[model samples]
Every structure is written in C-alpha cells, then in structure tokens.
Target: MDGFDRFRAPPPDMLVMRPLDSMVAIFHRPSGRTHVVASPVPEILESLGPDPTDVATLLARLSERFDLAAGDREALLARLGELEAAGLVERL
Candidate 1:
C-alpha cells in the first residue's frame, strides 16, 4: 500500500470513536488508548468490521460532508497522518 492508504477508516475490532465536545476521539481498544481528533473538513465515523476503509473513500466522504477545499483537504489528511503514526489510529 502507499502512504495515502494509511488514512483509511481503520478496522472495526481495532477502533472505536465517540463525539466529545466539538472534537471526536478515536480509540484503539486493542491497545486501550485513544486520541482526540478533529478536522475542519467533516467525515462520518464508519465501522468496517475486521476490514478498514481505503484512504480514497475517506477523502471522498470528507470532501462531500464538509465541502472542503483542496488546501483544507491536504491539511486534514496531514493531521490524520500524524494521528495514525502515533498509534492513536491504524489502517486496518
């Protein structure tokens, strides 16, 4: 997979998310940890069972939900990359 693939929605068993204040907190239950995350661009939290969604799908959803501009999309993806690398999230 390429770098973009890492932005996927993550596997069901490996993740959980809840809305908190204006932010969303994603949890990696297998590791008993969580991270508070937010994006100016909107997205729906989806559960994909053992499998995870692809990054393109996620970007599409976010773009649709928030009508994000190219710059916003890039920024949001960048922040998500940081979260993923921190083990606060995983790509399936």
Candidate 2:
C-alpha cells in the first residue's frame, strides 16, 4: 500500500490484449498465460496511460471516462488487487 503513486501497468512489451465484446483476452508473454478479464480491468488498463498513477488520480480519470457510481473505490481497489495478483500491474 505504500508507494501507491508508483502503481503502473505491466510492461507493454509483455502483454498482448484484445477486446472480446464486453471482455478482454490478455496474453501475458512473460508468464505464457492468458486471462479473460471483464470491465474495469480493460478500462483500468486503458486509463493507466504510459505513466505510474495513484489511486486517487486513477479514480478521477476513470470516473471521467466511465459512468462510475457515487462510491466505487472499494470495487476498483479490489479489481486492482486482482490485477496485481495476476501480474498485469505492479506497484513500484
């Protein structure tokens, strides 16, 4: 949780993502694994531009782009945890 501002998407060269309707199929070149992720995941990755971003900044950006509810922090954080666990994102 420390250094949250250092959170960033995985290295671009290590991922190959493709949209599949409402879902996304991400192929991790490093792990040689494929993941079928839903909304928020794809959206989150897209929102994470080319730089590291903190939760607050990311939340604000996501809110502007998506129709997020009044309180979606927990949900987004939870999804971020999952993505980190899956090695799609990292905290520096």
Candidate 3:
C-alpha cells in the first residue's frame, strides 16, 4: 500500500490495549486474540484515531512528536504491515 492509502485504527469497542512496562498487549474483541508489541507499534496505534491516517501523515506526526522513537521509514512501513495483518489497523 502507498502512503496515500489511508489506514484506520481498530475501533475502541472492538480493540483495547494495556501497557506492560515498555510493551503493550492489544486485545482484539472480535477475533478473541491478543498481540503484544512495543515501541513504534503502540505509539503508531495511539496516533491513529478513528479517522484514517495515511503513512505520510503518520510518519510526519511521529517525526514531529517523538525525538527518540524507534523505526525509520522502512521499519515504520513494515510495522504498519504487521499491524494490518494483526487486524489492529485497516485500509481505507
């Protein structure tokens, strides 16, 4: 997917995540599955609201807000792919 293709965070009613030290465990209600992740994944999901956010905007936001955040552009894209596969994010 390209940067122009928007992505949406999982609906709050359907997905929930709780912090576990530096990592987080995201519980997907519909799928009845949990995904544990760290760093940019949780931050990325938090920045993604109910509205769709393109990769460019996501990257821009992260760059602007975080000084020591992990993952460069390539890694960020890969992380997005992982989130999509986990059903934590969806294409718009």
Residue-level lDDT tens digits of model 3 in 25-66: 988898899998887787898788768888888888888878
* Poorest stretch of ten by lDDT in candidate 1: 41-50
Model 2 C-alpha lDDT per residue in residues 30-71, reported as the tens digit of each score: 889999988778779878754888888888899898888866
Candidate 1 whole-model C-alpha lDDT, 0 to 1:
0.57
Cα RMSD for candidates in order: 3.9, 2.1, 2.3
Pairs in steric clash, model 2: none
Instruction: Report lDDT per candidate.
Output: 0.57, 0.80, 0.81
**TM agreement with the true structure for every prediction:** 0.58, 0.83, 0.83
